[model samples]
Target: RLEPGGLTFTLADGAFGLGGARTPLDAPLRGRITVEGKDLEGLVAVAMGPEPRLGGGLKATFSLAGTAGRPVLTGEVALANVTVTETNPQCPEPRRRTLALPSVTLAAGWEDGRFTGRPLMASVAGGTVTATVIAQVDRRITVQLGDLAIRALPLERVLVDFLCHAQAVSGPLDLTGTAAFTAGDIPRTLSGAGQVKIGAGRIVGVQALRMLDAIASVAGAVGTLLGPGTPVSSSALAEFDSITGTYQARDGVLTSRDLVFNGRAVKATIAGQYNLASGALSFDVVAAVAGRNVRARVTGTAAAPSVSVVPASLLSPGDAGRIEKGLQDLLKRMR
Candidate 1:
C-alpha cells in the first residue's frame, strides 16, 4: 500500500477455494494482483493528455482465477527506462525532444470488454517494435493494431522520434502494418497500411532528396546526378543501394504509388501525397537525368517546397537564376 495518489497496491500469493458450494460466485479464485509505480507521470497525465510527458518505471500483474463474477485476468505489464518529452512540431526553440524507451512490454488478456495485447513490445532505436493490441473497453476507447511489426528499426530513430523531423538517414528498418485508432485521438485517429524495407542506406537530409537537388541545380544539370565523389561528407546527400515502399495512411494523409530511389548517380521513381497534418507535399519525381528521363514536381510545404522541371520547357534563364539563389540559401539555412 502506498496510495496518496501515486499508486501502489499488492496482494500476492493468495488462495480462496472452498467446498464447491455453488453461489457466492461459486467460490474458487486464486490470486496475484500487484500494481507498483515509480513515477508514471500521474498515470501518464491521466491517460495521454497534458502534452506528452511520460516518465518511466511501472509494473503490473494480475493473475486471478475464475470465480468472482467470472473473474479471470491474465497479466504482464512493464515499463522501464521509458521517457517521452514531446513538442517538436518540427523543432526550433530546442523544441523539446526526449523519447528513449529502452523497454516496454504488455502481454495481456481481460476478456469481456476486451483488452488483449498478444505482444506489445518496444525497444526502439536499437530496434524491435512489435505490436498486436486490441483494447476495446466499450463506451469508447477503441484501439486496434494488428501484427504491425518493425525490425531493425532505426531511421534516425524514426526521424528524430516519431517524425518530429530531422534526417540524415542510415538504415535498417523493415515494416509490416495495420492500425486503427481512437484511444482519445491518436493523431486524429490514425489509420494505416504499410510495407517498407530499407537496409543499407544513406540519404542525407531528405526532403524529397532536397527537392531533387534543387531540380538538378536549376537545370544546369549534373547535380552530381545525386552522387559521385566530393560529398562522402558535407552531409552526403545520396548513396543508396535500395529503398522500397508501399504505404497508405488516412486522416494524416500519406500515400504512395510505388516509391523507389536507387543511387550511385540517381535513379528515382516516386508518386505521392504527403500531409502528415499539414506539411502538405504532392510529389512526383522520375529521375535519371543526363541519360534521359527527368520529370519533377514537388509541391510546397515540407517547410517550403517547390520544384519544377517537366515540360516547363526544360526551364532556363540561367535555370531561373540558380533556382532563385538556391531557394534563398535554403530558406536561409532553415531559419
Candidate 2:
C-alpha cells in the first residue's frame, strides 16, 4: 500500500514509496493514500520495466507550502499511460469521473501562492475534454489545449455536460483549440473561454465542408446577424486547416472570440465573456459570421459578464460601428 508522506516507493529496483498503500509503482496500483495538512511534502515514482518500447516509467516530486495564510503547491509529474485523478471524499458513488488520462508528462514549478506547470497532452478522442492546466492556488487556472477530433457528437448532449458536468450523453465531438479556466471561490463561480478550429468530421446535426471556402463571403455581412443573408460560398473539405479564435482570462473571468463556424465565410463570429467570481462576470463581443453582418456590444464586470446584440442598421458599411460597440459594451459592462 502507498500513503501520503515524503517518500517515493517503486518496484523497478527492489522498491520505492511516498506513503499511500505501500504497494510499489510497477505493480498494479491497488493501494490507498491519505494526507492531512495545510502543508504537504512528498515524492512519487513509477518503476520502469525492461523494454524501452514498453514505457519510460514515471516520477514526480511535490510539496504544499503556505505563508501569511496563503497556500501554494510545487511539483513535477511524469508518466506514460498513467491516470491523474483527484481523490475527493465527495465522490460517494463510483460514477465519479477521473478526468481520464492516458500518458502523463509534466514539469512544473510553484511559488508566490500559486501552482504552475508545463503540461503536455499525448492523446484525446472526444474533443469535449481538456487536461493540461496551470493552477494558481490562491487565484486562477490557465490551460492551453490543442484541437480535437470527434465523430457524430450531439451538440446538445456535449453542451449540457460541458457546461454543468451533468451526465454525458452518447455522442462524439471532434474539436481542436486553446482554452483557459478560472475557478471562483465565493458563490463558487467557474469561468471558461476557448476557441476551436474544427476540421472535417461527422457531427450529429452539423453540415460538413472545408473551412477556407466558407470565409469567402464574410465581408458581406459584417454588422448584424439579422442583416441580409451572407453572400459567400465555400467547399471546405472538413479535413485540412482549422478555425481560429482567442481566449482571455482576467481575475476569475473568461472571455472568448466568436465561433467562426467556417474559415470566416459562412458563419458569424460569437464572442462572449463570463465571470466565475464574487460578483458578476459579464461581457460582450462583435464580429461577422457566415458573411452576415452580425455583431454584439456587451459589458458587465469581471464578476458578471454580459452581452447585447448590435442591430445591423447601426453598423457602418465597413462594420467599424460593430467593433466599436463591442469594446464600448465590454468596458461599460465592467462598471
Candidate 3:
C-alpha cells in the first residue's frame, strides 16, 4: 500500500525496532518510502548514541537508490563532537581523546550488509583528511588514509590527547597510513603501517643532548690542543631541521627502523619498538660524531622514557678503528 510518488514517513524523536532492539532517533527521521520501487530518500537531522565506546552526535542526509534489496547510498555526514576519556594504569593522568569532524562527504554503495567508499573526505583539526573507508556491518572496518595535510598541528596536543602523555616534541606533522580491525576489537586489534615526516621540531626533556654538547666541547678542546690540523666543532642537538620515519604496527606493537633526525648540532639514527597496548618504549639512538658514535638506549613508557648513554664499544665489534680513520680523514681536510 503505497502512494503514486511514494509514501513519506516522518518521525520526531522516535524509536525504531531493529533486530529485537529499539534504537532511539535523536532529532527527526524523515524519508520517502516506496513499495516495490527503486529509490528512497532519507534525512536524519541528528542521531546520537549512549554507549561511550560508540561515538555520538551524528547528522546526515542520504539517498538510497537501486532496489529494495540492494541499494546505493550517497550521503554527507557530520559529527559535532565525540570525546573518549580513559585512564591507563601505566599513565599518571587521565587520557582524553576527541574527534570533531565538521563534515564527512561519502559516496558509497551498499550491498550485502557492507558499505564501500573511495576517496572520502573529512574536515578535521583545521585540515583536510582524505581516505578510503570500508565497513562491514557488525563485522570489520578498514580505513586507508592518503595525503593527509595538517597545518601547524601541535605535537603536544596530539600526544596529550592520544597517548595520554605530556608533550615531548613540537612541530607540524604530515602522515599517511592504513588501519584495519574487527568491529569489536579496538586498540588491541588495530594494525597498520605509515610514514611520518616532521618538519622543524624541537625535542624537549632530553638530558642526553646536554651530554652530547659536553662531549662535543671536549672533542673541540682536544682538537684545539692537537694543533691546526684538527677539525672538531660543537654540535646543536636540541632542535632538528627535519625528521622522517617509517613505522609498521602489528598486534598493538609499532616498530620503526628508519627514524632519522637532521639538525645543526647532531644527526641521529633511531630504531625502536613501541608497545601501543602498554605504552612501553625501547629504542636505540645513535648520533654520528667525529671520533666515535654516541649511542643512547631509551626504555620505559612514552610518558616517562628513560635514556642512558652506553659505551661506544657496544656499537659493533670493530667500528672504533673505522671511526678513527674517518675522523683522521676529516681532520686532514682541515689541514
TM-score of each: 0.34, 0.37, 0.60
lDDT of 2 at 225: 34
Question: Over the full model, what C-alpha lDDT does candidate 3 score relative to the true structure?
Answer: 0.57
The residue-by-residue lDDT of candidate 3 on 73-151, one tens digit each, is 5555444443343345434454334544555565555566777666676655555566777777753454434433344
lDDT of 1 by residue, 219-305 (tens): 344334322433222223366776888988887677888988776666678898877667778888877654446687888888678
- How far residue 90's Cα lies from its native spot in candidate 1, in Å, is 40
The order by descending TM-score is 3, 2, 1
lDDT minimum window of 10 residues, candidate 2? 203-212
Off by over 4 Å in 3: 1-59, 66-72, 78-99, 139-152, 161-163, 166-168, 204-238, 289-292, 303-308, 313-335
lDDT by residue (100-211, candidate 2, tens digit) is 2345455565566455545544443233333455555543443333332233334333333222221111233444444444432422343344444445332221212221
- Give the C-alpha lDDT of model 1: 0.73
Best by TM-score: 3
Q: Score residue 93 of candidate 2 by CA lDDT.
A: 51
Q: Once model 2 is optimally superposed onto the true structure by TM-score, how far is the C-alpha of residue 44 displaced, in angstroms?
A: 13
Better of 2 and 3 by lDDT: 3
